[model samples]
Target chain A: MSRKLLETEGPKWVAQGIITAEQQQRLTALYPEEGRVVGLLPLLGSLLVGLSALSLIAANWQGLPELVRLLLLLGSMGGAYAAGEYFLRRGANDSLGIGLVGLGLILFGAGIVLTSQMYQLIGYDVTGLLAWAAAGAALTFLYQSRFLFALTVCIGGIVQGYSTGQLSGFSYFTAALTVGGLGWYWWRRPDAVLGGVLASGILWQAGLLISFLHAKITWFFIPAMLVYAAGDWQPDRPAGRALQAPPLVAAFLFTFGLALYGETDTYAGLLRPPLLAYLSALLAVLALSAAGKRARGRLGSLTDWLLLLPGFYLPSGLALAVATLVVLYAYSGAVLWRAQQEHNPDRITLGITLFILTTMAAYFKLTWAFMDKSLFFLCGGALLLGLSWYLRRAAARALPPKSE
Target chain B: MATPLPLARRHRLVLLAVAVQALFIIGVAAAGYATTAWGRTITLRTAPVDPRDLLYGDYVRLHYTISQLPRRLWRETNREARPNEPVYVVLQPAHGAYEALGVYASKPAIEPRQAVLRGWITNSWRHGLRIRYGLERYYVPEGEGRKLEKRPVLLVKVSIAPWGQARITAVNALAK
Candidate 1:
């Protein structure tokens, strides 16, 4: 129904004879053919007005009494909400209504702060931030507004950070709340800004996951690999709840894992639990992804799937690591192939980005062994140029013909 | 699926939403009013570090002088107070002002002017118990807060409510 869906897939379906040209036209027309919206203007105006209003209070005009200041803060907050509701009731200019709600939310928080300052009130900022975030999130649920949800998530992270002592003392309950709340919210409304939920989940995971890994740093990669595998697993094709945001989470996790790997050059730590843990977890993820594909009978044959997942039961950790990386590479290659087959531009874009990240990480990581700076740069430059040309030509050849 | 509320029903919910937010603001004011109207006023020495928090706009991070309470200063108590738990501190007359006489894990029944106040047990060492009444941080105007930081000792006016919760009402800088 979106413009991107029509533009990218319409021609592909037409070429493949999936739908008649007339049926395509009718299907596309079913969506409202709205022009680009001017929603940003009202939102921008409201932000400017909100900032100036808060700034006016900040000036602390001596003549204004404390009671009057409190009244002004309350009056403006109530007025904004009332107006926002009235505008929504009209069922026109919804952006303006949303903007008003945002305004009211901001002012409401500012009121708590201003009153705190006015009376020199006591309490940690966490107390107020949590309250503000809760109120904002409630509004988001009430209205199903993604923007306000995004706003609340940002504040909620602050609450998490402060409560846990800059996340140094992040408690188990906090981690559970972050994962649980985001998971529930996404399940209820997957379409509402996935950005916030992903961010909160990652902040909680990375903060807690890496915190426990003092020396066993590479183990951090498993959670992300699990996320990617979760997304990559689907019976018919690569899809599921994992497909929504886990791939992106996984790719970044892969990048971080590589960065962590690159930080070390020791051979001693390679056989440890972190490594063994990572290898086993990586195999489990690979097996899960392969199992889904195997069930659907998409990956050619059972032997082929066996080739993709090699040495899963291997006694040595090193062999398992090698097999896991091979499986990872195969899965990414499958993602690219599937993206091309389905004409899923988003998947293709993500695949390409991950490839570039992995390649760059490898290049820098390998070059780190060079003793002399000049030698490192010389080898790195050559590697970059070679990989650049090779990747460019491969990409060009992989694209669909322009005739389509 | 959520059935759409009737128009009148929607209006009432919206009003309720606004009222809830309004009530939060009034709650803050109500606390302030209670302190000013019925609570006793006391002054304590204070110091400032950072002057601004980007999230909450302008405010100074205040560190009160009473933050460090010696463990020996604690009177005969029923039990040891845990770290970061709200405990009542009994303030007695000391050096033209008041200092903590004893820190209790729970609120202690007190005389009319015994001055029982609520404070978090920041820490307790063999030497002393570090207590921070939530009134430690005093919010002030932008550049103005920075000016207060220069003074070695700034007098902080605290209004303690009938219920023991304290609020910093004012900060007075000492001129050299």
Candidate 2:
């Protein structure tokens, strides 16, 4: 049976030739047919690590002082390093690095939390801040993990820069320099790229949030565009399936940011400027999306419409604009249902699209709908329930019973 | 043009660096907490200071208790106030070194008869330190003092460092 299976796949493997005989041998040895259960270990390890992190965050039985808790967090980093070393000795791959880097992240988070808890702990020299920054950079280097390093550096930069009253786009630009430099250094490794993406997102959020707090309106739109650019830049690269999600997620976020700003502001408020600029900006995005060379069909269509949504703010267009989104979402759901029935397209992809559209419509109707929130919620719930039931049936029909 | 380091070596270095940084951050935090004996660090839920500013919208103008000072008294200490002037005060610690219990504004205060008498500010300084943030500001008009007489006053009692820098020793908040 093994021989037959190998014979069938061997030709394809040979034709592809991406995996050499030695690599194939290694794969087979690691996941021998009878003992393939061992491969589950990494998945199990990852789950445990994830759970521990959750537990650490969720624990409410508070006793330790903030400083003591921070010290314990530092100790946990030691444990992570030890775990990484053990994994290495046992010949594990980058997942070990990922886990260790996660520990570093937790520590960094703890540091930030502790500072806030300890009062406006200020007056640290640039050299002092850089010490922690260097440590964060070191974690990246140790794991060859650019993501954690980039994250550390970005947060450190924000803390340092913000404290000194010296934050700007130029600062963000400088931070991005690290992403390119370190990202390029780890070019062969996807983890590094992943790191860059995360770092960039954090920095973007930080800048936007700070700007929001300061009532600095101009920089508000930067994050939205940054997310859009991230999405636009992806799909061209050889990013893995996991990494592919972020760009699309970023795109959605960009649209949401625009919608949120637009819907929240009163028409006469000065804050409306950011919302207006965002609306115009979305027009350009819509045009680019229509240019159509990029990822086509549903994603592009949804994005284009999403960008156009801010036009809802126009008093004359408000009713029509909301109705359009609702209709589009309903149609997408119908299409997804049809796609599932035909077994010709990605059902989950269409379902997600339906979800986003539905959520957006609900948000607008609930917030912008004059004094009839209950009615809007009722309709939204009914639609969601109907879609869910339809999906269940479609899912049941598509997936057949498996034989052991 | 940097050569890509081997994954193993890179991983080791990154781990070490993160660990070290984490240690240093914790240390800094501990040090900050310890210094509370010099002055209290307080975060208030605040509202807008300018009544007209509130009329424009609902956001608040946040001010730190530490930043609050009798302007005339502060000016008098430095003689003439520059755009960025440094003022020092002595404090008593009620808790840790970082926590402030109360403060004595050492700068001279203006009096009708005394003219510019160098008087140490104490109870009045604590009253000024209670510059409210958040909903508290909303409830009180700009000219009005805190409505409740026994309101919680956040004070980090502190002493001056050798170089006349503020060093917190204790934090005392009036019980609700």
Best by TM-score: 1
**DockQ of predictions, in order shown:** 0.33, 0.14
Question: Could you tell me the lDDT of residue A384 within candidate 2?
Answer: 69
Candidate 2 local lDDT, A178-202, one digit each (tens): 4544444344454435634654544
Question: Where does candidate 1 stray beyond 4 Å?
Answer: A1-55, A61-63, A124-127, A165-185, A195-251, A254-346, A371-375, A395-403, B1-8, B35-43, B46-63, B68-92, B100-155, B160-164, B170-176
- TM-score on alpha carbons, each prediction: 0.65, 0.48
Model 2 off-target regions past 4 Å?
A: A1-83, A86-134, A146-200, A203-207, A213-221, A235-271, A274-313, A320-344, A347-404, B1-4, B7-166, B169-176
Share of native C-alpha contacts between chains A and B (below 8 angstroms) recovered by candidate 1: 0.48
- Mind giving the per-residue lDDT tens digits that candidate 1 earns over B9-81? 7677667777888888888888787887787888776544343431133555566656777787676566665
Largest lDDT belongs to which candidate?
A: 1
**Candidate 1 local lDDT, A142-240, one digit each (tens):** 776767666665656655666554322444443444446644454455542364355445445555556544445445445644444433343313223
Mark the 10 consecutive residues where model 1 chain A has the least summed lDDT: A301-310
Q: How many residue pairs in model 2 have overlapping backbones?
A: 50
